[model samples]
Target: MAQVLEFRLPDLGEGLTEAEIVRWLVEVGDVVAVDQPVVEVETAKAMVDVPCPYAGVVTARFGEEGSELPVGSPLITVAVGAPASDPDSDAGTEGSGNVLVGYGTTEAPARRRRVRREQQVPVPVNGRSAAPEVVEGPVPVISPLVRRLARENGLDLRELTGSGPDGLILRADVEYALRAAASPGRPAPALTPETTVASPATASPTPAGTRVPLKGVRGAVADKLSRSRSEIPDATCWVDADATELMRARAAMNGAGGPKISLLALLARICTAALARFPELNSTVDTAAREIVRLDAVHLGFAAQTERGLVVPVVKDAHARDAESLSAEFARLTEAARTGTLTPAELTGGTFTLNNYGVFGVDGSTPIINHPEAAMLGVGRIIPKPWVHEGELAVRQVVQLSLTFDHRVCDGGTAGGFLRYVADCVEQPAVLLRTL
Candidate 1:
């Protein structure tokens, strides 16, 4: 006997409640395999592909295309019979839904949204648009959203294929086409020194002097920040550090294979190492649980400033890696952040965070802790100045470090010691070599 099993939306990331269904990967009557892309949901951070948990013919779609659904809501149905118990397992047969326990599992349908299906046109392999690609078997294809973007932008899916697995068209392809169109007859925009002017070639030089409406990531960041600042009691501490040795060491190590090590990498490595000595700083204050949850690993967050807003992508287990490894990982995370390519894992699980405003030539800044995490380290630009050396005046490169911590969970002494530890590592680069 055949049985129909319902699949529900899973938690895309920590603390994520709901997501908008950007598009459906499979429709009613379509056959789908377990772990196949069944839907694409857009959360505040990024667009995530929701995979099928059960293998069977798609009996019904729970939510309509372009509708927001809460986590654990029925997403689709699959038929399971003489099959593997674990649906997410890579067994020959697609088993019951692989919805992970605890994070969330789909239950019976709560309420149904009006379903809508968009026409999908498939481009033939011969580089022509003949007929829609009729998806057969269990292989997932381009989502309806990507197809719609292709149509709206006059982008021939044949001209540019997908970088996604199994040749599936992705949102990136559509965005790339849009960017190319916008840059026509204009010089490719480069990052300018001034944040006041974003993409100098795109906008008029004359200031619009008009307030823009908030939406999307910008709106979300603004709302979240407002709540964090107004509701949470935050405290900050500042320390001036001598970074002369670090600057020289980084320049000397530039001839290596890794990504050009950045100052942020240096600071992150120091902070991670310091956390091992002071595990109390590597913790989160769980308000609901009324406990300070101390984490074992050092998952450092990089406070990346993008055109959309600030996004902190966590680099898991930074303490386990070396300086060069940390540098390469930091580069990868920030690049993904700017290009909007970060996955759910990369965007969450931050035990501590670092924000670099020193690049902007700012001497020091009190940055807000990315929250839950007890502390955030902000580094300023390195500038040459006169200092005491061997009882004589000398010019040395110095940078300021600002540390913000949750006073509710930590005292001034703990915060001070953490800052001093970072300062010692920055002042003497050789200290890190000894620890590593």
Candidate 2:
């Protein structure tokens, strides 16, 4: 007898609570193997392929693509121990012990069966066959947020027909039902094309502008920046430095180099050295304990803007990496960020951040510090400018360096010293050689 087992969205770690379904790999009646990736989802942190622990025939899927589902919501149901549609295959009953965080099984299953796609009747519960009369199973809903909204308004989801794909109830459906119930005699207004379920307030007539839901990478960035502004007492210090020497040193190194080094890598190398000198900036504040937590290792994070949104990929043990190594790691991480392949582990745990907004062709910016990190170094475009070099006014390559530091961690003196050190390294690349 086949036993149907429900598989919910597993916790992708990094304190994530929900994920948006990007794509589904398996369909109804398709045989699945233990620990096989069944779906790809995008969370606040990164894109993750969710694997199913059970090996069996997929009976049903709960959500549509692009719909947000809270953690632990049913993703799919599998009929374990079910006979495969293919005569040559057999559905395994045991679950795979290998699983993601917040989900796992006790033992590994036997050899996986060959996956075959065929529509099959849903298996009944407790070894009972389906009755002659059509029986409705659980309500078709994916998002817990939608369920909560319906529950709060005392609305019955089963009574309302869902407008989303696969008859999945959406937040807009609940809101529309609530509005229709509130006014008994009045006819409910037609939903326009621009109507969005992002919030109940926005589920009305078409607005003048388009409403983009901030639930993915954009939402994460917004939340982090807002929290950083509200919680951190931050201060910014800026300085214009002559980067002519730095550029010349880079050209010289590349000209004679085995492997070319990137300018961002040079800046990162300088940052690690500066952090070594000023360890105060390489720490985070423990607000709960009212103590400053100085980090021993420098997990350097560099900001990279991608099609998805702004992301900061961290390089582990950055202090121990040389310029070439930093260049390679930065390149790899930037590629991952651009392609949306960065893992949750790659996107977090940074003691300091380096923002190269110069690529945006900007001269300067007061960057908001990445939360939990004490400081961020922003580099502006290096352009030709008049400077007093060797007591002569000449056109020299100049770049603006800005440091935004948490005032709770250190005073202006410490921040200013750190900024000055970075600027000195930028002005005279040889200044970094001492630490190198």
Candidate 3:
């Protein structure tokens, strides 16, 4: 007899707790090889292809596409040692050792089964009547975030029926319940396929606007930006610089080079050089410790907007890389971001961010500092404008450089000095050679 082994969704690392099923690579009863990617899941960070560890015939599948599942939720069940059409290729109760974080196939498969059986005990709903007891089986909730939202608001999960697949509770369900509770005079809105929960302020207006649930990449961005605004006392300083020399230097180098250099790479090189001079900008403030931790190496993150959402891909050890290497890594990361293939590691650990909003055709913006990191350097569009060059009015390429820094780390003098040095590098490219 074939032993059925359940494969739960393994942790994708970087503290990701859940993922949405994007697409299923395999179907039930399909013979899958060990380590074969069975499903593609979209986490907050990136889209990942989760591989099955067991080599056998798939017996069952869980969670439909577009539905979110927690890290330990069952993905699929495979019958190991099952008879196959190609009898010689049967895996015979073997499992691939290769798996992501939080799971291994070497252990006996009955562990999870035992745990599931143990959790099937009956419990009273909110310590209410035991006559109508609620069996604590798999609660129709997957996302821990949804559970937390309901818990924090003192709402019971068992009371509200979920609008998701198989009555799965979503963030919308919890929010809708909270809103209804806040306004006791008004009748609770009926939950439907199209029902969505809006913010408390906008709950009563009943506007005909479509409500998009802030989940996945959009939700992550919202949370990070909100935290950044609440915690960091930030200040911005900007300066308009004549970039004629920088443009000329780039053109000359590309003209005589084997590999073309990117303007962003040049800006990053300048940033690393500036950080060396002002190490204060390349540090994060640990609020609990009440100390500013200065980072030794520069892990530069550049903002890249993709169809999924805005993502910042960090270039590791950026201070040690030259302009050419930075250009190549930026290209690679940007392409990955566009294709939604960037890993969690690539999307985090940014000591400083270089926001080149110039690509959006905008001249300037007061960029919000990426949380924990002390500073962000924003580069505006480089365009031809009449300016006083060599004490004469002339048409020259000019750009605006904006630096937003955490006030806790440094004062205005340090921020202004850092921005001034960056502008100097842009106006006179030779100034960068001093540190190079």
Candidate 4:
């Protein structure tokens, strides 16, 4: 007799509480090896492929793609020690002890509770079998999503047979029923606004627009920005500076360089120096403690827009790194962001942010501060503009710089001083040499 083992979704750390199933790698009765990835899930941070700890025959799976499941919820069940036709390749009596986000489980229950397929039934809630009740004496059903879908469609679960293991009612069955109801000339049951279901038949005609759900990375960005707007009393100030010298300095450095230095890296170097002179900007407000806790290290965060969305990847201990190292680190993090492989650590713990919206062709923007950070510096496009140089009007490469800061941290004088220092540095890159 094979013992059944239930595998729950492991806690993907950085305070992530839930994950939505993105894809399933295995099907029922499929042979799975220990530590093999069984499903791909999207959390707030990134997409992660979750590995199964048990090596066995996959007996059942819970949740459909795009459905969210909380941490510690059963993802799949497996029959350990099940006989495999190719035992040499498929069967294993051992288990994988691999850990994910500090979670690993290989223990099987002492006494196996054999749940026969025939005994599985839909649990009743408030006299409805589709209410996700987990008791005996009801129809055999699993996921709450299936029940919710059926209930919204007014489809009686007692009538439809399930295609999943042990007559389990899957989301597909409800979808199939809903589609059948919405067939031409077939009337859809009237649904309430709160209980409405999406379908082809009774569904209202969609206009020429796409509706993308704000989930995953996009959702996280929305939540963070909203919080920053609601809680932080942020103010922005801007100045235009002659970046001709800065641009020329970069050219000369690259001309003399073995390793190319990025313009953003140079700006980051300037930011670190400014923050060092005015450490008040590198702090977070602790609302609960009624304190403004100053941070020690400069974990510099810079904005990088990817296909996924706008993400700010942090360069750890950036204040301690040279311009060359900063350029390399930024490249690595930006590539990771584009590839969607950035870990939660790489995305968090920023003391300040540099928003180079210039890349977007925008001259200037009042960018929202990344939450928990005290300030964000915004850089605009460097374009040739008429400016005064040595008391004469001339065309110079000018860039708009804006700083958005939390008023609770410092006054306008400090902010103004910081901006002036940055502008001076850009106007003359040699000014940074004194700080260096």
Candidate 5:
């Protein structure tokens, strides 16, 4: 007899409570090797492919794609020590003893799993799954929002065939049905001659703008920013700097280069130095204790905008890394952010953040501090402008620098000092040589 082992979604770490299933890699009856990725899920922090711990034939999977499952929920059922349906199948009897990333194996009780046959759907008298005119049957809908939309629209849910996994109804399906029903010259559902309702021509028209749901990365960003604004008493200080020398220094390094140094990395290097001098700016507030907590290591985060949303990928031990090392790490993390392959660990635990909105052609912005962190440094576009250089009028590369700090951690004096030091480093690259 085969022992069916239940595989639950393991703790993905970093206080992540839930994840949305993005895609499934295996189907029922497929043989899986231990430690093989079974599903891809998107958490608030990053996208991860969950691997299985046992090598066996898959019996069942829970939750459809786009459905959110709490941590430790049952993910799949695997039949171990069972003979393969196909003679050539090679699922092993033993387990890999592997676990999800950032988790450790511990004492878990032996699980007993029961399998049941799927219910069979009846074919209509016409020998079809659905009728010719409309898809009439029990609708498969899970989201309460979908239910509410259908109820309010006076549309029969049975008339629609869900486009989601296993014919499951989705919010989009409900919205599409609504748009279709409201379309002019088309008939509406549940409208009888006795019923008095707004006609298609008079019914409130759907807005022309597309309604994208604030979910996934976009939702996570909104939540964090809202919390930051609500909890932290933040203030911003800015200074204009001449980056002419800094640009030339970068050109010289790249011209003689082994690896090209990015302007963002140089600014990051300056930020770490500035933090060293004014360590108070590199701290977070302990609200419960009513004390300011200064951090020792500089896990510097840089804001990078991608198709998913704005993500800040943190560089670990940034203070220990030189310009070359910082450049390499920035390149690696930015690429991971672009490809949506960054791990949760890569996205969290930042002591400070650096925002370079210059790429977006902006002059300056009062950046919201990433929650629990003390400060954020914002850099603006560096453009050629008339400036007094060496006691003479000259055109130089000028840029704006903005620092937003948690007022609870430091006053304006400390924030101003940090920003001034960073500006000095930017205007005169030699200022960093002294610190280096």
Candidate 6:
């Protein structure tokens, strides 16, 4: 008796309804192991490879490449066990979260997975899959950003090799090409300047031009920002603090071999301590329950801005972690955001959020609140300025802090006091030691 398995598209988070099939790793009639890479789907957040949840011969592909399939749709069918007319064989409610990428529930498959794929191979250094037959070509190797910059600067892309990681071209490469062209070094290559210009001498007229689909991370970011701004009633407050002591503490703790400690880690510690002193700042306004729910555990949300958009990946039980542990977890979560490898579990259940805009020289700006979470803190860049200490002028390092909270639940007094407490902790980080 052979068992048949049906693979359905699962929820890809942010409540996505559909996704485009970028590529299929396996084809019909291929004998695949359980949890083998079956297909790659482009969601609003990233391009993800979903594994086969059960082992069997590939029987059918319900969709084709580049097709957009709605979440909860049947993607493939494999005979893994005795075939049955009833579809209830896999309909176990306990495993609904196991749906394939871009597929959601309500269209869930009613079967328990006998096995699921576990290992995944990342995209190769060449920015393409490791499949055979791709030969070396003179294609310009520039980063996606550098490619955009080159086009904006009217530089030919074919003339430069990327100098960045994995042969990714940099903006400097394009600048070099421009400088070389302006001088007597070499004649510039013939290229089309106007994007829409057509020549009468071509062998074939360019077919109706293709438009790059705005489907993945880019599209999702636009939608989320739009929703967050329109729905959330946000109020922001900014405070300035002397961070001289914080900076000195960081300098003294720089060890040659241990995990790198950063000011953000210390700030996170301060924020968690402040949350304990004032639990109201750490509560979430649960709309469904029509009440504000204060979480017992301190799961700090680290807001990361990637090329895809803004994401807040949570560090579970942040209150329980020391400086070193928080630093390690922060590094891991940051890498996860950049590589788009964060699981749905790490992306959810944030009690309080923090965004470090100071790294980009932003002194202060109103940050949008992550939905359901009542507030978020923004850390600004530190600068040296003169300050009056005991009525004497002295140079001091000062940093700015901003807090944005939902006005529906928190009053101005409560929010202001919370920001004051955070500022106090940052100015004198020793204030956090007592809470610990």
TM-scores for the candidates = 0.64, 0.77, 0.77, 0.74, 0.76, 0.70
Cα lDDT of model 6 overall? 0.70
* Residue 300's lDDT in candidate 4: 96
In candidate 6, how many Å is residue 270 off?
A: 0.9
Clashes of each: 4, 0, 0, 4, 0, 25
lDDT of 4 by residue, 226-323 (tens): 99999999999999999999999999989995899999999999999999999999999999998999999999999998756788899999999998
For model 2, give the 10-residue run with minimal summed lDDT. 112-121
Residue 36 alpha-carbon offset, candidate 3, angstroms? 0.6
Cα lDDT of all candidates, in order? 0.70, 0.82, 0.83, 0.81, 0.81, 0.70
Number of the top lDDT candidate: 3
Tens digits of lDDT, candidate 2, 301-349: 9998875678999999999999999989999998888767788999999
- Model 3 lDDT per residue over 1-436, tens place: 8899999998788777888887676778777776767787888898777877888888899998668899999999999988877654545748875785322334433211111211222345787644434443445664544654566467777676678996688778787888789787886654332234555774677655546678888888898899999999999999999999999999999999689999999999999999999999999999898999999999999999986779999999999999999999999999988877888889989999999999999999998889879999999999999999889999999999999999999999999999999999999999988988
Tens-digit lDDT track for model 5 on 1-436?
A: 7889999998888778888786676779878776777787888788778878887888999998667899999999999877875555546547767786523233332221222222233436766565334333335664433554676467666666677898787777777777777875775553221223343665678444324556667778888999999999999999999999999999999999599999999999999999999999888888898899889999999998875678999999999999999999999999988877889989999999999999999989998889989899999999998999999999999999999989888889999999999999998889998889
Off by over 4 Å in 5: 85-90, 102-210
Instruction: Please report how far candidate 6 places residue 383 from its true position, in Å.
Output: 1.8
Q: What is the lDDT of residue 250 in candidate 3?
A: 98
What TM-score does candidate 2 get on C-alpha atoms?
0.77
Off by over 4 Å in 3: 88-90, 101-205
lDDT value, residue 266 of candidate 3: 97
Question: What is the C-alpha lDDT profile of model 1 across 31-70, one tens digit per residue?
Answer: 5555666786766676667666665666788876556798
Q: Residue 108 in model 4: shift from native, Å? A: 24
Q: Poorest 10 consecutive residues of model 4 by lDDT?
A: 108-117
Off by over 4 Å in 2: 87-90, 101-207
